[model samples]
Target: MPASHSSYDSGDEPRPRHVAIIMDGNGRWARARGLPRVAGHRQGVEAVRRTIKAAGEAGVEVLTLYSFSSENWRRPRAEVDELMGLLRRYLKSEIADLHGRNIRFRMIGERDGLAADILTLIDEAERMTGSNDAMTLVLALNYGGRQDIARAARNIAESVHRGLLRPEAVDDELFSSYLSTAGLPDPDLLIRTSGEKRISNFLLWQCAYAEMVFIDKFWPDFDADDLAAAMDEFAGRERRFGSTANGR
Candidate 1:
């Protein structure tokens, strides 16, 4: 189909260069199946692997996933432990494979809050795959949008106090550089699973103009086709970027 506006009407359909996802419904999937939530989480890991491959094949340059949120610490101790254990195992087993595939692995969030071992593994993964040029996979662990923005604000204030930056110099671009996702493009598309419509603190500032797609399938059941379908939906959108149809 032709683009709604001629401003960006190329021969090929519009595709999102950066896609962010909020993987939800794992607990619900497990509870409905009478299985422990951990089982659902494990299956969700498989879905993550599949989506990585699928996204790369689909020409997506950057993929960001909302994994463990900071609020997840409020869950029961035993469950949290299980989740951490799974994270550890995933890091250990998947890093080498991802590196071999020429994919860059990155994690964004509060590193101090993560266990020492996990932090070590994350550093290693980032270091090993730092030069990869195929695709970028970003996992948001222990992340909160509000916390990220607040941290950026604090850093900006510090810069001004130190005379390194003036209060008048702070603009949208300067403020975004202070964020954890500095140097990365804002997500062009955002997807949420399990029929959810809320953003749930995934990417508040970055997704200001992202096309939001919600799927009813639970996260554990998500696969390559679902991602492809979401892409198809994305290709059909006309991003005017606050411009009117006549302007485009």
Candidate 2:
């Protein structure tokens, strides 16, 4: 596991290298305002833009957003289609801007189920932003924690069966490399909006020791101040990471 950020003192509180967020409550926000759900999602996209700027300004090396989950397929087909359409539009509109900002763009989770046109756009965005080194923005689409783990396990088993990797050679690091987030640092902090406390099947393995901050505001209402507040909360906590506070 990576070193825990909770060990740092106040003055030495290093910015989290990677921050993952579960952007929640778009529908709830819309319902509360008597607006269509897609309106909230549209506003949520604006929040995404602001948060990206905030994270980059805060010196976070990587930002991962849980954009869509595998289980979200259970929603009404119209809603799903609307979300997909929004995603397509976002990619088309934002890729160039992201690349210009020197921000690397990446997507994780299953890709086979996405529409062919969406896949093509994703590929183009990734390729265009591949060389940028300032920071990375990772979107978890069609992702599930259990599914990710299962896929990694299957891949490892196949490698071993093919005589490419010995069973004894399989360890935590090797196993992690087989996961979707192979090259990215584990999240130092994870924030979930709308007061939800659970991880919701996002980054189960990678967030083994990440600090979590839950807020009452919906995704569309989240702003730079809220993000700063979360960071402040993170800065105040002490992370023991299974050891004594004295680091014994």
Candidate 3:
């Protein structure tokens, strides 16, 4: 049976095969407890681990995480430096375990801004696990939906300028192929922690038909039960993709 075609509840509704998460509220989680922001970020890693295991258990085929946004560079210099160091450490320590779990790793974002060493590390990780089949874990670092769309548009324009693509032939599918997420399926469910109601410039076009799940739990505080709740809620939704609930 196909992944999305199965339902955990009675096999009636379609289960979300791909789930995208915007992990938010790290600073707030720290502030609420009078702890340093770094503490919250550290605990957030635990949440990531838990979420990954939970996703695997739920049979979700793809899990995309918005790790660091392009705008995050505007944060305090010290904090940004700390985050980079933490990311490097996490990558080094977790790659083996991720590969062992049959997780295909991929990073989505412009690579020019990253340090050459970090870029190489990311490349190595991608190359090492490109053939995994259990599940794919995509980390969106320094990513922005607007930037992705703009890049896709630029590519389309270049193709048209070179007479490779006719302007009249452009459509949704064609435009999407020019994006970084060209060969990936769109997220079936989008979850944002910290009760944030907005998409925050994360997958604007790809999430057009995704069921949204907003939770009040902070990223560090989120756990497997939280994921289950989100999945349950998603299973209850009627995703018509602009059509009626009856699939009309």
Q: Go through the candidates in order and give each one's C-alpha lDDT.
A: 0.90, 0.91, 0.90
Off by over 4 Å in 2: 1-12
lDDT digits (tens) for residues 1-248 of candidate 1: 11322222353767889999999999999999999998999999999999998888777889999999989999999889988998999999999999998999999988877899999999999999999988999999999999999999999999899999989999999999999899789999999999989999887999999999999999999987788778878888888888987695
lDDT of 3 by residue, 1-248 (tens): 22442355355656789999999999999999999999889999889998998888778899999999999999999889888888899899998899999999999988868988889889999999999978899999999999999999999999999999999999999999988787899999999999989999999999999999999999999987888778889877777888886875
Candidate 1 whole-model C-alpha lDDT, 0 to 1: 0.90
Worst 10 residues of 3 by lDDT: 1-10
TM-score of each: 0.94, 0.94, 0.94
Candidate 1: count the clashes: 0
Give the better candidate number (2 or 3) by lDDT.
Answer: 2
Model 2 residue 182 distance off true place after TM-score fit, in angstroms: 0.6
TM-score of candidate 1 to 2 decimals: 0.94
TM value for model 2: 0.94
lDDT by residue (tens digit), candidate 2, 105-204: 9999999799999999999999999999999999999999999999999999999999999999999899999999999999989999999899999999
Candidate 3, pairs of clashing residues: none
Model 2 worst lDDT run, 10 consecutive residues = 1-10
